[model samples]
Target: MGREKRIEYEGAIYHVISKTVSSENAFMEEKDYRHFIKLTCDAFSKYQAMLLSFALMKNHYHLLIKTEKANLSQIMHEINSKYAHYFNSAHIRKGHLFQDRYRSYLITNDEYFINAFVYINLNPLEAQLVEQLEDYKWCSCRYFEDKDNAPRCLNFKEIHNLSGIEIARITQFIMSKVSESKKYGREIKEHNSEENIKKIREISAEIQNKYGSIVKNRELKYLLVYALCSKKFKLVDISFALKMSYATIRRIKNKVEKRMTSDAMVTEWLSEIGKVNAFDYQNDHKVPGTL
Candidate 1:
């Protein structure tokens, strides 16, 4: 199947995710992260997009943005391409730096928008990269606590106006315990149900049975990981089910996601698996490419 067309419109809000190839570090050091932030500031200024929230992870980064015009594709292309060029040149590497084109999910409602904002802020915490959200210097979450020091890339005033909530309230939501905050999102709530678990298991088994003979063990594992994640199962849930560490599961998922974009065979296998039992592959409430 061909790539899905992005939904673009004036004043559209999006939850965007971009990952590096093979789960490599996108930011190798503090300077690298700072440089990426500089690029982001430039991109926002050039494109007239409002950067509401962001989190830079080891291998991936998330952005919650609102575009003034129907040009999200152009904005992201410039940011990713320019950053990729810089990263490759600085690191003295060749070939694609990013896994694929960034994935974006349209934010349609205030509640969902708030959820995405909190979700982006909580990424570092969820990955166990920081003991506290404040410790993660790469994320915009810290700026919320100290707006006076926030960089030009973020627009706190516009965020407040668009979200219709005070910054304090949004910060409170983000600072809530993971268990409580996880309950607010529709995707998380649905994935917690017994029915979703059953479907995920069914899908995993079908993929194994269909492709176990031809694919290598590693490849098959990634296929199962992709199936579970695409169905909205949390990384923790998948870790337990697959008997792998959380980090490993996440890496496998990223690998599969990258392959799906470039490899026709991988795409065909996943597309066939999605057909089994007539499973509902379309997750309307999910912010694609999120944790």
Candidate 2:
């Protein structure tokens, strides 16, 4: 039978678990664990995902997440695939590290939510790997025990929303659940923002260097807009960065997305462009003597 469909929706929360394919420890050492954590952080940044809690076990791991967009597949794919790459290269092994597709349970109620959250944190203690949750270095339990030590990847806003007098009370609740087997768990526009614009300018400069000159300013604009969007930057940020009007930025983004998705000519042209150094082509403008 085909794989089951995931229940997906904007603002949907899920408890995601995945294990190594062979029962071998995917995280073989401290560095391996830290590397995976780094990749996890990168996924958070790229996807704008909210990571409420997580635990990294020897052969398996768990994550409690709420996505701002309906993009669980994309988020998980990036995290798993990227981590797999790093794991393989570091271990000098070749093959699937994770077991079959990740298993995720949708959290539709507070009961399940609390259960998953506590369950994940208690994984180490349940496994007898550590006597106290605070001693486990990889899982997020330490951060919950001490907020100052929490990494940037943790989403405290949601944690603070818990129905408790203070964070300490919430931690106590999570700890109680853990005793029961564990508990639950941007860039700107170019000008006004130097960072994104710097990226855009770099791409523009490379294209110019490759093609000798940008045939039209619109081509330059399209490239800048496309680069910004690819970074998942906001349209408003793109507009401010490039000093373009919001409508113009939106138009470029929409046109680029439309053409790239539907127009064979545009797709082939982009592929060809990527092969060589990035270069600008006039918008709807033929190359020299083509028209």
Candidate 3:
């Protein structure tokens, strides 16, 4: 069987989709996600590829990128292979991590280019992994949102020139697309679905029992807030569910955000609890009386 040709050339733009084999979560933990992001940045630097936008979902990722040189094949190979190596070594697994060759569509026209950009940015929200685009910290959406400190890997100037749309209008355009995608997604009808909210409470109670002696209430509050936020629950709803005031919920959320940004260990256990809760939910496991 002849290998499929990747139409490569200097200055070619493409929408690339990479998936994991058997729908396994390629990035199940925060550290794994961070490592992949670092490898992606390295690959971009190595190949001189211009990343317009990207979103890293659990089992797959979407990238809107332009090649500065005809090196898409080399770039993808390096990124995927290196990440697979790291994942295999860390997880004690073997064999192929990626499903197959990455799927890519050439962005030939301006309309498709803009569509690809917005679509990539909306992946997390559409998958119900996040309530909003900005909430997904791993995405390049932040680069577009924060113009003053825009990413060097992402050439906003090139995107602006190609689309003839100013940077000032980019956020609004992306927001509109996100709003449209959410309409179809609508995965979580309410911020606090009763079942999931109950799951959150159960997870909290379990954590409190195990770590309550050593952990302070303030730290626990930070954990709860961060975990709920990561699960796509609204602050107001989390406040109501956890019996905290809106102001307190917001404060805790901010504290956790700052800790995470500063790479502190504050509420790291709580985040682990959140991951456990998610795993439980997926496996339909019961926790004590919660059954």
Where in model 1 is the C-alpha error above 4 Å?
180-291
lDDT per residue for candidate 3 within 1-291, as digits (tens), equals: 986356678998888879999998898788897888778878999899987887888888877789989889898998899999999999999999997788776664565567677777777766777776677777777667776654457778887888787876776788787655455234323321334445556666755664462135665557756777877775654664577787887877777777676664554454455545433543223221100
lDDT (Cα) of model 2: 0.68
Best by lDDT: 1
Candidate 2 has what TM-score? 0.60
lDDT of 2 by residue, 36-144 (tens): 8888888988888888889998888899898888889899998889999998999898988888687776664555566667777777877899877789988877777
Candidate 1 accuracy as lDDT: 0.74
Each candidate's number of clashing pairs is 0, 15, 0
Could you tell me the lDDT of residue 95 within candidate 3? 90
Q: Where does candidate 2 stray beyond 4 Å? A: 1-4, 162-165, 178-291
